[model samples]
Target: MSTGSFVSAASVENHGVVCDCGLPSPVRRSWTRRNPDRRFHTCKGRRVENGYIDCGFFRWYNQGDPSGWQFLALLEAREMMEEQRMQIAALTNEVTTLSMNAENDVKSKELGNRCEALKRDVQVLTERCIGLQNVLIASTVGFGAVFGVMMLMWTSNTA
Candidate 1:
């Protein structure tokens, strides 16, 4: 195809440019080892997995040499930004985990303290119950002794 068939980058509408095959052009990344990061517009037919033909609608969205220092710097900066974003996400997840663990630890300590207090209360109640039982036994024995002495006096007077 002659170069005239391809529209200049500025001449094409940003939203609604179609290829000669009557399909919209999609911006795609170049996977060539030499220019992996370069972007361009092409026909969707080119991406088909079946035995389909390409429309050859080509235009460089990032028009520059992939080997140039400025382009390489831009790519490096993009890679660094992605790495930083991933690090931020990982740190956020770690912070959430640590926060949950700290909260659980505090709750466990409080539960243990409550359990100890309940045990001490139960010990005090048990001591009180034992004291009450001892008092009841002593009173019963004293009453029996007084009743026996009165019965002896009455029988002696009658005899």
Candidate 2:
């Protein structure tokens, strides 16, 4: 393909390996559905563009046009990649769960702190109410004693 991302370092090993070009033959994978995973060596300058230039240098890396071992290797690589993707998904889920738990803990602690503050306020208000009740009782008794003394003085004068 025109895209070079699939190019392998193994391709460089083919440099001067067996090419009549006496130069490198970069390894390239076939993308056609007919031979979906086949690999081959071709001239480094071969183009799949409008020019479609080729140096007439070609060789199949897979034996007998399609090798059983190469197909197995491709399957193994796909399986390994799938396993890694599953592992990453599991780790991501764990991180999200841990984050939610941490948030819950912080919220719980804040609620407990607010409840404690309210309890202290209630206690202070109760103490002030008791002090006010005591003051009212004392004032009532003083007024009653003053009234009794005034009645005694009126009866003594009337006698």
Name model 2 segments beyond 4 Å from true: 1-66, 154-159
- Tens-place lDDT digits, model 2, residues 37-150: 667787765456676555667787665555476666776776687799999999999999999999999999999999999999999999999999998898898888898899
Badly placed stretches (over 4 Å) of model 1 are: 1-17, 26-37, 43-65, 150-159
lDDT by residue (18-103, candidate 1, tens digit) is 77788777665554334645667776664457666867777777677577775677667767877999999999999999999999
Over all chains combined, what TM-score does candidate 1 have?
0.61
TM-score of each: 0.61, 0.54
lDDT of 2: 0.71
Error of 1 at 114 (Å): 1.4
TM-score of candidate 2 against the unseen true structure: 0.54
